[model samples]
Target: ILTTLPRYPIPSDILTKQHVVHVQISKLPTDGVGLQLLELNDDFQFVMSELRQYYDEIKKLKPADEKAKRLHQNETFEGCCCLYAHFSENGMREFRRGIITGQSNGLAMVQDADFPWIGLVELRNLYQIPRHLVGIRQTCVYGVFGGFNMKTENERTLWDGICREMCRPGVRNVATFHRSAERIDYSGRK
Candidate 1:
């Protein structure tokens, strides 16, 4: 499991999902015996402003001409692309940052933060992320819910359920675990 720590001045090693980030967390490995998150050093507001700005910029991008689009599509199918794709989770569909890990027949295998399973997405659902955004690292780190004894079948089942719920789309409160319980909660609006 991974735990997030609040570091002062935002260490250089810490990477954010967006270029302009107000709050950053340092991810570290945990022994699975402590709390899932640590308290932040300062009060911070978690907002989707950066994400909204990203989508706005994406919307402004002009569609590539047919020839160029075809070339890019071919590259993607060959697993030579790290691009954005429309992924569906918990009945919610949205574009997510992913890379083409593998391909078979007409489907491309995609890996992204929204789900643990590798998604098989059609070529038409994939889009080349704008060049500027392609370099940005993923905002959240993947971690399993701790304190479960996987040796037992029952515990394993429970652990899997917890992970499924926590990773469900539109759940912003997972990131807020580092904040105090009394703090105001914000919905992860798209």
Candidate 2:
């Protein structure tokens, strides 16, 4: 698939490069299941409307006060987003979101002007890479605003199990509460 593009997709190398799309896939090789999500540039605003709407939900989860707004007042995010996906029990393909979430409590609002993820756009340009690709799996990312924290042993242990189990063959049940940041196979939902 990547051959159609100008280069083979390398996640680390591509991130180092401009305005390129980062597509992460979570796959269960034994089950022939996979979810693919593209991280686009801010210039692609049309694709980000749903993800941007999550800011409203986040605000509602907080107290009804100005302080709550200030906590995540930075209304702009430099990264891309894919909000929803369709699932089929019959014969079809799926390209969805793969999110690793942490415990909910306290505020984890990040507003970095020069987020490292944003620099990836220019790096891709340097290598004459295309804007679209299937990025290498990024199992661990830190210090980024919307990334997981791999500091504690307990958290690390928890994440290890989650990742392994999610990729297992019989794990057909995929669920997520972050509607805008994830894609849930809701076919069974009443």
Candidate 3:
């Protein structure tokens, strides 16, 4: 559906005016289910209103105080995103270099690229390669954030599996690839 411009909680005048209209599927007598939602519209604000409501909920979760405010300001959750990638291999390589050289943060690097590729790195059991993709090689290497300390085995397993799977499929296409930087953002919230 068409969504309106985004509004954060701090902007009361603009944020309060917008309401999120959610359309859900319902089981009908004949039809098994139905899909419904407001048409995508640029004029109607959508995600921003919902984010504000979520922000309010998060704020209320803790005791009101300076500590709470601080927590709210820095807290990270699934919905409370900082940044991530959705781009290409060359783009990811550039991003990795920037981060290693203190030129960018993980979030900023991923978001900066036109299509963030590191997003696929999040997959645990399976490998995700862009099917029917053009350009790029299969042997390209990628490093996941917090690889050794947090999840040494799972991380290695994922990489190895991806390598094996890609070789089998004969799809040597790396959309996003990068090396690890020394400085790390432990929180992974952003």
Candidate 4:
């Protein structure tokens, strides 16, 4: 019935059908008792590692595109993250193999702040005032293979980490816009 009605595909990182390996430590992992490390299979670990690597790659892109003549060289401009659009199966596979393929530059995903399952799309923009800077902002959707599993508090923490990693001293600014219970506007800066 749901399928018969108008429906849109959603992207999800953590799906109920897909088994995810999680490790829990009540106290701390000690060598004898506290140090019990949960073993994650190579496949799961590898997938997680790949996701992290992709995240890193997305963070590294300059805020502005090369074609911008006036603001291309400016260094103080900040970039924002937005959603791209849904990709094909091939594109999804390429995303999964981002480390080896290095073909993430062209792939697009949906990114809607209102939706829980959104993909990311990156764009280039310009800014000037304190300093001229050019860089790309990202657009994101939940993605077909992975869905966000973070809780409200966890989401904040993850956002903090992403901003922290994206912004570095002397580097260009990275801006993030989030709208949920409260709207948060931040320029990835100290």
Question: Which prediction has the highest TM-score against the true structure?
Answer: 1
Residues 86-159 of candidate 3 have per-residue lDDT tens digits of 33334541111001111112122221111112232221111111222111111111123223332466765665
Model 2 over residues 155-180: C-alpha lDDT tens digits?
Answer: 66765675676556555532221112
Off by over 4 Å in 2: 1-119, 122-151, 179-190
lDDT of 1 by residue, 48-115 (tens): 24334555665666676422332244454544443443544456445555666677665676665222
10 residues in a row with least lDDT, candidate 4: 28-37
Task: Choose 3 or 4, whichever is better by TM-score.
Answer: 4
Off by over 4 Å in 4: 1-40, 65-190
TM-score of 2: 0.22
**Positional deviation of residue 7's Cα in model 1 after best superposition, in angstroms:** 21
What do the candidate models score in CA lDDT, each in turn? 0.40, 0.27, 0.25, 0.26
Ranking by lDDT: 1, 2, 4, 3
TM-scores, each model vs. reference: 0.44, 0.22, 0.18, 0.18
Query: Which lDDT value does model 3 have at 131?
Result: 23
Question: Which candidate would rank higher by TM-score, 1 or 3?
Answer: 1
Better of 2 and 4 by TM-score: 2
lDDT of 2: 0.27
Stretch of 10 with least lDDT, candidate 1: 22-31
Please tell me which model should have the higher TM-score, number 1 or number 2.
1
